[model samples]
Target: MEKTNSASRFVDLVQTKKSFEDIKYWTWSEMLIALKQCQESPSLTNSSIMLKKCIDLLSQKISLADGASSSASSVNSSRFRSSCDSKSTESLKTNFASTTWWFEDLLFFSTECLEMFVQSMVSHEFDQVLLSKFLIHFQKSKFFNATSDVKMKVIESVIDMLDTLDENVLSLKALFDILRVTLGLNINKGSKNRLEAMIGSKLGHATLDNLLVPSPYGANYLYDVNLVLRLFKAFLSGGINQASPSQLAKAANLMDSYMVEVAPDPCLKSSKFLALAKVIPDSARKSYDEMYYAIDLYFEMHVGMSEEEKEKICCALNHKKLSYEVRIHLSKNPKFPLKSTPSSPESQQPETENLLQNINYSKSLISWPHNLTEGINTDEKEDKSSEQIVLYHGKFDLPADNERFKVHLEGMQWRVLELEKLCRKMQTQMRKILKSRVASSYCQVKSLPKLCS
Candidate 1:
């Protein structure tokens, strides 16, 4: 009998809390140990149910005590217990249990216990925002520098938490941090694919700095190209693209900037660079000037990088899309393999051809005041092209129009600046022509006088 007692005590795990009617009587560590043991058992679901009920009991007790406290302060300093205590009225005790009553205690739980707790809270339909904040707070308390085996457990729990979150409210920085932590763990890629999707869905909202997830030490590449590549593919795969061109543009532009930043790293390979650069469709970018700039930077740092590779990279840039300044720069770039002459009709229209027409750009820079009530008409009057307006937001609550409206406004501003520059150049040329004609007329007048003599 003593040996049997010793065997059971050796395990020291409390498998069930069926006896604890009020969880306030159960110590924090006692509950933690009990839950951890429950996680390994077949009756996990029942244990979770019991754990939740215990939490509910604890909240009711605390809340009721708080409400029924000694607000009626008279001469009440006696320590003797009242034998015939009267129950507080419903009006005095709201009996309201807070959802966050369990958040603090959850901090000490292992990843497994925390995940199960989160699942229970979510099943109860708690406010997702509050829950997400608690998770973020819980994350800050964890030791990220823990062993690979430990990190893998943490990452798995994080991914599970991410799965339960509303993507709209999922913090992008937190997502990035999770990926950053997994860099050297060498865990199975399949496990993190969900993380890629989570990051991708909201890729448009991400900043350049956040996208710059570096490769772990000993990695041949300077940055984690494959990770970002998967994210890019996942972003495109998700149907969020239907929303607006501007957000798509934002992602493409972000990728372009990322390319530029990573280009200078000597260890980065040409194929990897192209892999990321090519993920953004050609039509998404407003212009290839940034892409061209990134390619140029890549070529500059990687001198031995093959001419064929340079040509392949340059081929991705549509010459017509290159800004006038970029065209000039590319033409002068010694390494640039000039396939087509820089004098393309699309790049520069003859002055006489377009001089007759004032608003001669592709689309008039007019503000097409599209009313939200009016259904979007995508006919020739509204071809579903790059300029098609989509919903976006800026400072404060945006008007019924989306952020695409902001994109249109920015395009108009750029066109206005270009027009302004053209006007200044025309004024200078006109002044020069008038000065030359005057000098010729004066000479002719002097010659006429000489002829008369």
Candidate 2:
């Protein structure tokens, strides 16, 4: 008890700093070295005392960077600029606009340590974008040539902190990169499925290349067709009510391009290829030319496909949606797949369902922005309950037509875009001010060299 009291007394003095009249404060360089020493000792880094101190020091470093850009001086010894990795230091000199200078410093830590470290950062209420950017950087570096097992661990670690991020902070490309790395890895099936679901929720925004995931080793196929199929199913699982027509169109077109790229793989089975093609609804395809060419490519590569198999492949296409040139080409081929037989009802069932579901979905969508601004600014249930109360108490009638409702949402979307632009403008002005402060801070240093050569 006496020893504890003495140690506590020293800690309090170091923390409070009121009694120390003469002190030589450690630079961020020194503090960072100390922090790294603690991080290397897992026991110390995990402990509350060490973790809190590390968090406090990191917060100050970031604050210092934010308070002053590196351009403030040709050189400085006091803060983070001189203390961090040399590459990071040089990068900072060139990129004065970015306040996130610490992202590069923590890239070398193990995934387990990063998980704990990132969780700690999240707890400290660090900037959400900072956390997200670090995760992205970590993902890219670790997943570069990591084995399947290592990739799984990385995914698991990233997923934990990724949950804390607000929507849109992490880009779809980054998520797709993670998905690509995680694919074909022998991880838990449930975890992979969940990852697919998470990525699918935003798959509408995915570029065509994002869907081109390669098959695992030993597979004859060039790409993992099954993964794309599962992703498409997950994307559609939310139904038309959740996805606007434009988003659906984007996904369908992206899948069409993906099929075209993978169609030449002779080992790709007809059933697997057709399944993905058929999953796309007819209304979603503005043009079937790409789909037709993909089917044609598959036919050329795998000529042994039976008549029924060929018909099944061609059924994914809506002849009416095909352009004049494609229709002419299909008409000329004697063995053209579509020429085998008309699309049977079984083959067209998914499209019919999609159209009917879309009509029902149009009527069921919420008129206001409940779905739009969900999980924002208020507790979801309370926000919805309050909205209902307003509707019940005041005679407010929502637009019944989907078009009018979409217009309202679009208007809100435009206002959001305007606000985002305004926020960006404000950030630019603030950075300019910070840059000026950096310039002023340089002028105040009396011992500084006469001029930087």
Candidate 3:
């Protein structure tokens, strides 16, 4: 009964507010207090009423502000009775301009109120009407033009609701719809950074990866795949270097999925791979594997390209050996099988035979200086069936100073070198990917109709 009176009084206060001062003096403190009471009480009927009143009050203030600013030229001379009344009109505009700070504050308070209302609804597990209204307003309202800090709070609230365990999947889906709409805005830089940090903390690998694929939002509202890609790019490039390992792994998985979902755009794919490589910690073996897998999958998908197209890609391939940093990690268990196949059978056989037959793979290095030819003892003979001469770049050191340990180390080093070859091939593949994109872009431009500037 007390909650009912409080709710009725809140509605009366809001409906009676005619100016900024009235809103400030009438609702702010009383509304929060009434909301708290309603939260504590078993019935949220009053809380919902109070929240709706606040929303309506905010909308009324915004409408007044908009009218004051926009009607300056549209007002007729009859509207101002005399010079004194004209002064009053000018004063009204001045007051609206001066009260711009109230706009941001109102938005911030509304978001807070909405967030509280959402929490109450989720906790009570009732009041779908309030949730539905909030989502609709958040999705389509002009309140988004408020200050960056307010925008950040709004996004923060949505993400908080998404992270809440009490929130059902339907509520989550509604929040996602809100996010998809929110993300479409040209958010300020500060808000984007804050948002990325929130996403890293809240949205994990699976969530991000699922975003890469298009989600069907019923027959009327199909989720845009391009928008999801833009969001993914924002998450990655928006200070993603500071993301945690788990976030990095999720980003890697998202990139992998992006490769498959988007049409064959080499530049986009390569950029994602390079970005993933830059952020992924060297210790993140699973992410590295995903990166390689994505790259290998690209090559596999494009195996049907013409011979000329293949040459165009392969011509950019770098024959440079792997760096020492990569070689060291190669010796660790960071190796994953390369899923790439050669462009042709003819190109495949020689490379396969060369890699397999010649245990001294380093000696077969094409990038080696021609002046170092004399260093190779061509006259040396080896038992092909028995003692394979393994080339060591420098002295090997192990904690155990035993011959058996030395043999094991040598074998591991050999495998590492083999992995190094694969890494180099991947680097070459990266160059090819970049070149292919450039070539494709050029062809597209050339195909376009010429126009006068």
10 residues in a row with least lDDT, candidate 3: 333-342
Per-residue alpha-carbon lDDT of candidate 3 for residues 1-453, written as tens digits (9 for 90 to 100)? 755675666555545543323333333334445444434442443445555554444333333444432322334223222222344345446656553433333233455666664554444343344344444456345345666556555665555544443333334345455555455455556544543443434344335434643444442323344445445555555465555777766655665565445424433433333443344334432524334344445455555544444333333222122222332333332222222212322232344334434545443443222213224343332232223433232233323223354356467558767766776785576567657767877978754222122
Clashes of 2: 0
Model 1 residue 143 lDDT score = 53
Misplaced by over 4 Å in model 1 are 1-101, 144-146, 344-453
The digit string of per-residue lDDT tens for model 2 on 174-281 reads 777777666556666766776777788888888877877788778888888888898889888977668899899888889888888988898999889889788877
Which candidate, 1 or 3, would have the higher TM-score against the true structure? 1
Q: What TM-score would candidate 1 get against the native?
A: 0.60
Model 1 clash pairs are 391-402, 392-402, 392-403
Model number with the top TM-score: 1
Residue 425's lDDT in candidate 2: 71
- The count of residue-pair clashes in candidate 1 stands at 3
TM-score of each: 0.60, 0.55, 0.32
Off by over 4 Å in 2: 1-49, 60-98, 108-113, 120-126, 139-152, 183-191, 323-332, 337-453
Please give the TM-score that candidate 2 achieves against the real structure. Answer: 0.55
Q: Order the candidates by lDDT, highest first — what do you get?
A: 2, 1, 3
Residues 47-89, candidate 1: write the lDDT tens digits. Answer: 6555555444333333233433233223321211121133323
Instruction: Name the top lDDT candidate.
Output: 2
